[model samples]
Target chain A: MMNPKGTQPEDLVWECQACHVNLVEGPVTLMYMGNRITVDLPQCPRCGFVLVSEAVALGKMAEVEQALEDK
Target chain B: MTAFTARALSHVPHVLRGITGNTLRPGGLALTERAADWCAFQPGARVLDIGCGLGATLMYLRDIRGCRACGLAISAQMLSECRGMPVLQAAGDILPFYDKCLDGIFCECVVSLLVEPPKAFREFCRVLRPAGWLVLTDVYLRNPQSGAGDLAASATCLSGASDNTELMKHLNDCGFDVILWEDHSRYLTELAARMVWTLGSRELLMQLLFPGGCSAENKQNMQGASPGYGLWIARLKGPKR
Candidate 1:
């Protein structure tokens, strides 16, 4: 799959910040404004730590919260 | 025949295709072909195209793949254009078919517009035979917050879109096993671009439709809020106990 920016898959790199291990993309549940949203993101394989990049956090997740609040 | 054709032509302006392009759904017939190829339907497979707007996909399936394809649309006006095809005027949540009757279903960009998607999914499960395939494509929210403060957006299928996780749960809850899930957000973006070009301005169309409901700033703010589109190929599990 291409990266969020539409670049080829080879162009992107994913690594966990805390463990410094290569992170595999997987599903992670996020809580925003008391609602739960599950999205796939890079994660730490060993520690089960998921990484939410700034773009996704401020972009998609933020937008989802807004829509839910609108409802 | 002329009156029927004229009525059908009148209905065309009501469809999104009037503002965008033919085949109101994103990715158009190319995506339909891709979904059909993915389903790999066998000859004489009984397939139903839910929300089969314009009946183009149904015709393609019938003429090209030799499938026994029927269509269902909510609008009687839309059904007028589909006189040559077997079609029924009905909603997706309450299908008029017996259990385990259909071999496959093709629902494109219709689920998001459903008021009760869960009920519709259950209905899909009920109608399909064991191992029956379902080819679904629709927009999904990558970011929900982008749709806030506007009920009209839901009417446009933006607010009703589920994230991937929610979508998976819905399919699983309905006894479907997802065989493939592909992100086709690029096609949606391209369609949006085309709409922007053809309509001259999305803002102009939004204002004409929603008037005071949608504003220029709000439209800009909600731009990336629409996550993307997805294509799912799922199969109905064996009969229930």
Candidate 2:
């Protein structure tokens, strides 16, 4: 199957260590401050282990925290 | 910064209702439920929802809460979406009702958008029965001294926010005594963050939501404004004195 639009893997790919399989792009739901927001991220299809990339961690995650703090 | 066209931000609820859980404002109907619970509105109570974007609260009030709720919206486009719901097209400052007719008014996320807040307060006072409750959820200016004139021409709620002292005075002068004040700033911040994440950046979110225009500088101007959200529950004492 082809990756969905805008779900291309980042420069650094991640493999699930336990499942011994490469991560595939899929939907992930993030819960924060009693709210749930869904986004696309890399995860192991076999074991469903998600990978949080450095770019996403520092980029959108930072934005979410900045939004939550309000300070 | 590119300027927002007239009433651009005010139209946010209509454009983004799909992603915002079919409600026009932050915290959606969850905030509405909280406010109604706080007011202890009985079944069959007559309530008005000012700025009722798509009349989600109207359905909730009538079907779930068992209240005789009517909604008012300044935008005809907003009212057009309310199929088979009890709602009206009108401004908050000029409500269409006899004196002391309503049991409560849900002015959620709308007070700060009023062009003439004092006038709207008087209208809220005039339309409510004695001790009739008002539930207000709105964005507020966090830093009163800074960004004083930056949003002079913007149509967002940030343009109309005032310091707490001034806000309380407005309520008092309109014969309302506040029964509860709760800080819900997280809701506003969370919504902003979600928009930023979904749209890639705050600028992009602004551009999409307000098609007129937005620039990087407007983002800075917004940060300078330091917006916050709050919920206020008050009861009308009598006619404005």
Candidate 3:
């Protein structure tokens, strides 16, 4: 599996827990602040499962929301 | 930096400027102007701004203080937005400048986000001329353990934040003398509140921006995190050896 930018191995390992397939990095659409934004993330190539690391889920995402809302 | 985190940090200045006007940091241009005043740059003095964001403070220094200012930012998007301003794509920890060349440095709200803050401090000392002033403002953890184990909070510049003691230690260890330290946590809290009010519903806004990121429990933890913000003015020790 290719490593995503800004993600360290300890931060996240791209493998689907259910499908047991190594995740590949790609752009995936997710709902943010009621808007659909496409962001790069690790996902299972076979099962389409996106992996959200704890840092990305809480840290970056929350900051993005706050910044957008401030606008 | 991860693509998402980079995008988020790059987007913050543009978004906040739209709402809060020119100054992107917590206390606005007033605080920035005050910091510039503290730096006390002489006419034609050369200065650098670390993590310059949108170059607002650089402009202020040039136009208001008669200083020749350049900025360093990691975000290409931000540098492009600067539109001919003397901003380079660079990180604070590895400044691309000759030793003891700059007259002063102005860094706001950027320290907490640094991956290697101690290294950055050392770099700051290296770049500044002897007795050059360094003005900085950033968030710090009021209670070190308040956000322990919260990966998200760490990402938001809330985790790994040092209190006054640690900051002073870094400055002194880096061969800088503290000139001033001011608590501005109230202003930061006010800014946060203003952002929430502008969005109408904080929870709703979070849901939209980071679905599955902001749970009720996480929000509660953040509320109780006891974060604080501060501004510091220091000077590099004289006669670089």
Candidate 4:
């Protein structure tokens, strides 16, 4: 129920291009197949645009999605 | 008794205890109620719940459904939690009961985890009355060939999951007539999805299940098995004795 390692592998600070704000790791709720999970991920503080890094998009996120689908 | 569930009880029994305190296993007590309905035991009939963790289902059967229900749990911790309840500490393979003493037996998510399922079923046959019902709900394999043999006990339910054919063979060989077999696989996928979210990832779930991290072979074996949850209501075959 706690936040997992969701940021990209690199420790580089990501700045939102549109909001011109630094993305901070905050609570992000992801839903798939009628199941929801809240985890901390990088997001713009002002606009609340969540940044799901490529590593997370391909790694933990994808893995959980596959497991849910059972494919 | 070398049950995966017993081992898990030693590690993360608290988490499972949380679930069992409410509704253990897939489809929850709704499935239990369904099994009870299908079994159709008369009121005040003596019944036994095998591996009755937390004694929730045992309470339900006795209090709600009006049966004289007692339970047998393998875990000492679980048994300790049921202080005032009519529960006994015993293993499924070696139930300490007289022959033909009970009208029904209810076991959920316990048999497959056993080191020897047929042995326990044989025990069930020996103890159950000729007209007794055996209500079982557990995971089974969709792909008959896809499974881990010796290493099955390493994972959770997937470890002991054999295909429906093998299960049917076990039931038939143990002298039971299959009354019903219904697949409730969506419950498993839904629960797995919820678990994935709650634990953050499949790997975290695996880690929670297998503390200190599981081996590649164990993980691969778990992932390789195509498991499906099922409910079976069977009757011990013989004229009432």
Which prediction has the highest DockQ against the true structure? 2
- lDDT by residue (B117-159, candidate 4, tens digit) is 8888898999998868999888887665755433454456665
The C-alpha RMSD in Å for every predicted model, in order, reads 14.0, 5.4, 15.7, 6.7
lDDT of 1: 0.71
Candidate 1 lDDT by residue in tens digits, B26-100 = 777887888788888877999999988778898889999999999987778778888688998777778889998
Per-candidate chain B TM: 0.86, 0.87, 0.87, 0.87
Tell me model 3's lDDT, rounded to 2 decimals.
0.71
CA displacement after TM-score superposition, residue B115 of candidate 3 (Å): 0.4
* Model 2 accuracy (lDDT, Cα): 0.75
Give the C-alpha miss distance for residue B239 in model 1, angstroms.
4.9
Q: Candidate 3, residue B31: CA error in Å? A: 1.5
- Estimate the lDDT of model 4: 0.75
Which of candidates 1 and 2 reaches a greater lDDT?
2
How many clashing residue pairs are found in candidate 3?
8
- For all candidates in order, the CA lDDT equals 0.71, 0.75, 0.71, 0.75
Which candidate wins on TM-score? Answer: 2
Shift in Å, residue B120, candidate 1: 0.8
Record all residue pairs in model 4 with backbone atoms less than 3 Å apart, i.e. clashing.
Answer: none
What is the lDDT for A32 in model 4? 83
lDDT of 1 by residue, A1-71 (tens): 35476664324777667888888887776655554444457788999987666655565555555544442
What interface RMSD, in Å and to 1 decimal, does model 1 have?
11.4
